[model samples]
Target: MIINQSIITDIKNIIVQSKEKAIRAVDHQRTLMYWHIGKRIFEEEQEGKERADYGTYLIKLLSEQLQPEFGSGFSPRQLERYRQFYRVFPIASALRTQLSWTQYKLLLSVDNEEQRDFYIAETIKNNWTSRQLERQIYSNLYERLLVSNDKENVLSVAKNEKFPSDAKEIIKDPMYLEFLGLKRETSYYEKDLENAIITHLQEFLLELGNGFSFVARQKRIHIEGDEFFADLVFYNRLLQCFVIIEIKTHKLTHQDIGQLQMYVNYYDRMEKLPHETPTIGILLCADKNDAVVKFTLPENQKQIIASQYKLYLPTEQQLLEEVNKELESFEEK
Candidate 1:
């Protein structure tokens, strides 16, 4: 009798899948246990009307009693977090089974309810790991998108209630590329930056926002024997269009904007199908002047945009100041 190697491989795959499913089931049960513990504690505190005066004492006493019997996981600090978890969620039916306790713990740290809800929906949609969720929150993904777009509309997208109609809706101003491990002061060629982004493509895509898939890098174009190369090309399924990106290591100028406009026109006329929407060109530069961008494009421009890129994450205070400045500018307009 001849032994089949394919059957052996199939058995291995089945076993691995079974183990994975079992692990997920266990994790879901653990998450439910924590939520129930939080619910019970919250109910007890509310019934006794001791949350304001003796809440800390109650948690401490519970920890002292439970730790020796159960484990250190029942510490006072963890119990406090559980209490906060219940306070934030409140409804048992609203808890997501896909999120583990670790993800919920990180989500609990977000003070804004809308932001927390957005992250929750996005984490499930994107299947983000706990580390990815942490990075997104730390990078202020919600605030960055809200800086340029309407708050309600962006949150709606997060909840899957509405889709992005235009490239601008999904694109963020001053994209944070701190994951590339590049220094802002360093002088590097455009190719070097592009290579780094490619090497860390997963992190780059997260920074690029949702529904973007990589298409090409250094895509060649020829028009009447004049050749050009686009730095990066991506297709956003949500927007249903191709995105052409041009990289500049210095402040943007009218000439750069004109070049990007040509790329957009080229893609629209030559590359885009009749059923497809217009291609969008993005100028990712180290800096940009709003006035320059305003003057370079036509008054009714929609397909071309110039945005600044930062190699490092900005401090929360810096981001707050920038958002405030943008709001003030919008009010003046």
Candidate 2:
């Protein structure tokens, strides 16, 4: 009396899917409950009481009573969070079925409305996990993109309106590779950094931004009997071009720029299809002289991108504490 292997597999899949759906359903309900709680608290606070005093009083009293029946999720701090969640999102546009209670909580930690909205948009577009969303916020991803790219493109990303038509919109200056597990004190060679990137390729892709697929590493190309090895090669679907990266563990020089430019030329001339745009060359180095980079590249240079890499990343707890500090400062004011 044994079950068929395929039947067992099918049953296992059903159980797994059901569990996932049940979890999603529970999360959705919890998020809705929080939203409703927030709304009621806001309405009650607005009636005849001063916001600073009455709001705090209402949440504290509510938490004390609800804690005995419902456990610690109804703590005073949690109630205040719910109130803040409502205050930020409001009745018009707060509830998104796709986002869980935890994700919404992360969004609520964000102080700026536009930045919050942008995070929401990106989170939804990329289907980012709660952890990924947290990382993006702390990393100042929106701020970084806003630097080189235009405001409209940045704001309109969630609207699905022509995000990153060019390479510059997605590329970051001083790319953070703290996920590579490289130590700051240890001296590393270019190959070591490249190896780290290859090892943490998934996180590297996230740092690289959307629509990039790894093509090759140490791609060998021969030009008139001289052979050159491109450090890393990637294809960006958004920009429709090959992105060639050369890692330098030291300050960028004009000669390094020239070498990267040559690699770009080879890719554009030999590798890329006619329909694709010109190859984009990037030199990811530790430090660089902007004046040198400016003088080295052409005035109309859109293909060549040079970015510095940082080895440290802020922890989630640190970012959460920063948010708390900001909130405390605002309260003090």
Candidate 3:
């Protein structure tokens, strides 16, 4: 008897599909169980009518009995998390079936309700894994976007209720590039930084916010007898435009903005399709004076942006300071 390769391939695919289905079913059941546990704890605490005085003790006692019988997952810390989860999502129907217990546990750590909602919506929309969700939260993605956009737009975009219509809507200032493993103290050329971004393109795209897809590196364009190269090119699906990025290792200048403007013009005229929106240009530099950028572009400018890039993540306090500074600048304008 001869064994057919096609038969073996079909059998393997069926087994793989079955395994995936089984895993998803188990995960869904586990999430449901945790939610139920959280609901029970909340109800029991409320029934006692002295939850404030005895809630902690009740959780500890429950953990002591449950951990010994069921395993370590029912520890006091986890029970507290479950309680908070129930509080956060009082209605079980609001719980996302796709998310796992670990994902919900991570979401519970976010204190701000609006910010937490944004992360929850984005996590589901992007199909982010637990690790990805954790990384985004730690990098302060919600705060970073809030710095650039009003809270309403930020939440709307995260929820997929509104798409980014302009470059400013999606671009984060002082984009964190710590994932590239570049040291802040080291002196590196623009090429070195560009190389690092290309090496970690996936992470770079993640940091660039949603809808960005890499198009080219050092894309060349011939004009007259001279040739010019764009450092990086990406297309944003939501905005329906080409995003040209020029990396500068030092502070941004009027000249840098002007050069990027030229690149934007080139893309708009030469590369962009008739149906596409105007091309957007970004000057990603180590530092940028908002005043300089404001003065350099025309008052009606909408396509070009200058943003600083940080090799390391800033502390929450630092991020708050930056947001306040941005708000002050906007007020002055």
- Colliding residue pairs in candidate 3: none
TM-score of each: 0.94, 0.88, 0.94
Q: Tens digit of lDDT per residue, candidate 3, span 56-124? A: 888999999999999988999989888887888888888777787788888887989999888988888
**Clash number for candidate 1:** 0
Per-residue lDDT for 78-100 in model 1, tens only? 88888888889888788888888
Cα error of candidate 2 at position 117, Å: 1.6
lDDT score, candidate 1, position 29: 84
Q: Which stretches of candidate 3 lie over 4 Å from their true place?
A: 1-14
Writing each residue's lDDT as its tens digit, candidate 2 over 254-316 gives 999999999999888888898998999989999998779988888968988889888987566
Question: How many backbone collisions does model 2 have?
Answer: 0
Q: Rate the local accuracy (lDDT) of all candidates.
A: 0.87, 0.84, 0.88
- lDDT of candidate model 1 versus the reference: 0.87
